[model samples]
Target: MNWKIWKKKNDHKKKKTKTREWVDAIVFAVVAATIIRVFFIEAYTIPSGSMEKSLLIGDFLFVSKVNYGARIPMTPLAFPFAHHTMPLTGTKAYWDGIQWKYHRLPGLSEIKRNDVVVFNLPVGDTVALENQEPSYYNLIRQSDWKTVNSQYTITSRPVDKRENIIKRCIGIPGDVVSMKSGIMSINGKIDPLKNTGQMPYKIKLTTGNVNFEVFSNLGFKVSEMQQLDGETYLANATSEMIQKLKPLDFVKSVELYVESPSTNDGDLFPLDPKRKWNVDNFGPVKIPAKGWTVKIDSNTMPLYYRAIRTYEGNKVEQKAGAWYINDKVATNYTFKMNYYWMMGDNRHNSTDSRYWGFVPEDHVVGKALFIWMSFDSEGSFLHKIRWGRLFRGIH
Candidate 1:
């Protein structure tokens, strides 16, 4: 064998054009990033003030898939990095032609109570392309299905491709959850997260013309404060903020704004006029766990109907005063998947499980770990970065 000639030939074969090298490097980077995002961890941002005070609107968080198990992508054919829609084009980013059944890779732990969790929006199966803020169902409730359908472009999304939402898990499987006067009680015990959560408060001032700057210094956004009367204003604030404003000289009284249990403003979960469940006062309804069986009746149907029919994928119908699931008379129902009750830390401002009902286990995405970066849009150029919130662990 000619050793020198053989070595030179091999070396020449190994050498690549600049364009080929760049293409190989780019492909490798994209594959590596996608794997890490799907199986390990991914970045998320607080787009709304729903988790205010605990997790701010500008905080960028690294949600951990290992904490509650990484949910296998149901819609596997997707553009890398884009969530639901393509950037600039505003077109569908994922192909729903191929979908896998719900499966999760084993993780360090199951989702626990009070854990900040990210999950697919349960009611987000249908969405209005033009106006997505109120949700498709909510828009229908406000007007009617016919009106909303005519008003905007409507589309249905698969389980994983639906909008991703982050909230605190108030009730885990088999837990009884309720609320009274804007305070939540889980299993008949008051929620401990209430102390850290924010709600609307009626703040009365001693003088009609008081400086709003004082409230701003106390971390209350001026836009969130609404004047109710001459000397009274309604503001969304945390318990800590309420405490700080109480002893102020110009303050008359700072009281929590609790809605009356009797108030039937409608636009709640179940949407039953008879139930009269408001945001401030609702149920002792139990969160369904896997294999949990319950007798199906007219009363219980209102609560679990959506879960059984939609989340669990059953063909449910009522005929001749008899309940039928999958065309079979169903006097009793057994849940196939565990359900969770999720609520925002900004209790008053959030649209959560209180409105849409239970979130199935399959919708679970990841657990929020910490804020890797925080930017304040309301701050000045030099103070735009929230330095203290950077690298802060999420509760």
Candidate 2:
């Protein structure tokens, strides 16, 4: 046996040490790939026509991950259980906060207004407090099975998810938004929509709720009324937006606010706040103050941040829940982060803040700088090329 082993060792030496080089190559490849995925580029595909014209169905693009800070997992504090560990073992350790590396955004400046960006979905997030004597199984059982028609109806999206969506940002923090005749306004200013070689037509400026459709991601329907231009914004215009744009005596008409809302000019208002009106209306309210103080009584809390904070995020502990703000916890609420309002350029088609309100600070993804490629799939893959939009920077 010893003679055989010696012979095998001598044979291996003669064969050369190519195995070590192969191992090193693999390690280097993995490290390089991880860096690219984490800090540089991310590939995403359009999920639907909701963002039609700008980002079409089947369109694919590379979104730069480092446009915002990269969330690295192997930071110094990531030691101990740096990789994996025995599940449920009390001996295991992990970092609850970002350790070693200082938390900071490394790429571009602050997220700007009118930048088509992506972020985490702020739909249903909540926390709960259990009773001292509560049984563990009961809590689990309650979560598993619940009343059928409750307001917090938990539903699931289909397994195949859309990779990414591209839309133009119209509003930002502290913008007073309202719509008239389907026109969009930010901070009392309406977007000055010029015919950037897009189809141009004369739009009527009527008062009150007039139903029209522009491109939008969310399918929004209704709204209330406020005055502008000469038209009254039909806040609840969903049921009222005439499915057909029949030049009716009663139905008001809206203009094309953006051939493309991604332009720098879109950031500026279309008309003076004192002049125009439209329902695809928006803004007149300030974005929620990040780190600002406030009271959370049952009353005011429901307006400003209530629908988004407690309503959208965790436990609605109706426990005479008089929450405190900052160092002052009473019946008041305070903001721990800033809030932003976003809308799609396709006003009539998009269901954004009007139905699903407020995008939080942490959810900011990246400023859409350019469209490396764009595709529109009317039928099959071979015919999906949208050649006109390729290599175009996000206006």
lDDT of each: 0.87, 0.46
lDDT of 2: 0.46
For candidate 2, lDDT tens digit of each residue in 246-293? 255664565433333222221112222232323344335456665555
Cα lDDT for residue 189, candidate 1:
91
Regions more than 4 Å wrong, model 2: 1-23, 71-103, 124-166, 192-283, 295-299, 304-331, 379-383
Model 2: worst 10 consecutive residues (lDDT sum): 155-164
Highest lDDT against the true fold, candidate: 1
What pairs collide in candidate 1? none
lDDT of 1: 0.87
